[model samples]
Target: MYQLAPNIELLFTEAGDYHDRVRAAAAAGFSSVEMWGPTGVDAPSTPKDLPALKAALEETGTTLEAQLAEPRTQFMIPPWDHSEFFRKLDEGVEIARELGTPRIVVGSGTGFGGWKRQVQLDKLIEIYQKAIAQIDGSGVTLVLEPVNVRVDHPGSLLDRTSEAVYVARGVDSPSFGVLYDIYHSAVEGEDMRAELAGAGDLIRYVQLADAPGRGEPGAGSIDWVERLGWLRASGYDGPIGLEYYPTIESAASVRHIVEVAARA
Candidate 1:
């Protein structure tokens, strides 16, 4: 069976504060939750009170599934500067350790405007290899996310799951993997089965939002029952993150997903 982790950054807007949002998720019966980053800039700024957020998680008995690591700073593509990227990654690792988060999501910046495709890909592999070395024993897994260019994240170099899988395969480290976002894959017109076949065990984390609108599961055209069922059958027994924008009240918007998970 697959576990569900709500992305508190997008969900539980009824509660204005970050810690309160964690509380809201727990109140809604979610035992695990995910977020964009510790800085809170991705959704809101939760930078001031991580201890309070930790306390809320402890109080509510909630566990964090994963979080993005300095998403604003692009590391996977372009100029390929390892200095600032490594610095931010160290900071992110410390925060993850503090919060007991096991995985960190990474974004591949826009493709190099003037570089050759093969050269860019080779450079990306080198960057990730060095990054994996930086966090060699941190016990935190880094997941490279491929955002779709069709509707969101246009100009991004790593917009296809196959490319992410290829990068992960080249890195070939247990600490490195790909973050397979179902919505992004669907928007890219990828056959999930085929792409996932290539990804195999390199998929360390999974996130979801309905395509076309990036809303609640049932709000879009994707078949939640079928796709999620495919995930289970494919041997991916990991948390499926709820990273959608709510179309209705936060709690109400997730009811359909909860039902589907229960039946799944």
Candidate 2:
């Protein structure tokens, strides 16, 4: 059986502090937890917060697997000048390094303008190329994710899974890989297993969130249990992320998500 981490971002809205959230996650029997944003969710998690988060992980034996840069806060843009993009990316690398986590989820912001769209493509590539080089010694990897434009994110600049993978390879670094999100990919109308296998050695992370209702694991038709089997069949034993919008209480939704995965 694989270890599943309950995402606390959607859980425990009643907690007042950041550490309270981690503590709740630990109490929930989750082996790991993930959250978005460095601040404004409560206190800004700085280099200082890492030790408390670390202690919570230690006390609970839970891993802090990943962190989101909060939507539209940092990085994630098309056609940004190389200097500006790399600067933000470097900051992300620093966050990952300080937290002792290996991966940070990268979002593609809404499309850019002024220059031809094609020029933005080249700039995006250049940003990745330059920034990834800086993290060579840091051991932090960037995982680019594609979001759906139809239901969840309509104006998302990156829609196709193939395009995201292409950009990942275009970045051409050992650490640069795509975070293959089945939910958004499914929303865009693609065979999840086929696309995942197509990624082969390049797929670094796999996250799950269902469609239609977009609730906990079995509340929708994502077939998470079977999909998990696909990941196993394909030889991926790494962390599987639960990035869903909760239709029920966050903690209750987590219980249900865990139950579904367990039954699977």
Question: Which candidate comes out best when scored by lDDT?
Answer: 1
TM-score of each: 0.94, 0.84
Candidate 2 Cα misplacement greater than 4 A, ranges: 40-51, 70-84, 114-122, 260-264
The lDDT, on a scale of 0 to 1, for candidate 1 is 0.85
The Cα error of candidate 2 at residue 157, in Å, is 2.1
Q: How many residue pairs clash in each candidate?
A: 1, 0
Each model's lDDT comes to: 0.85, 0.69
Residue pairs in collision within model 1: 40-44
lDDT of 1 by residue, 1-264 (tens): 567898887899789777899999999889899987787555343563789889988899888899887745464443555687788889889998988899998866875568887677676788889989999999999999999999988888888898888888889999999999999999999999988888889989999999789999999999989998888777788888999988899999998889888777
Candidate 2 per-residue lDDT, tens place, 1-264, comes to: 556655556655466455667778777767777766543332333322666766766677777677764333233344444455455556766766666667877766665555565565565666667767877888877788888999877866678777777778789888888888778887888887787777777788777777766667767877767787777777777777777777776677777557655654
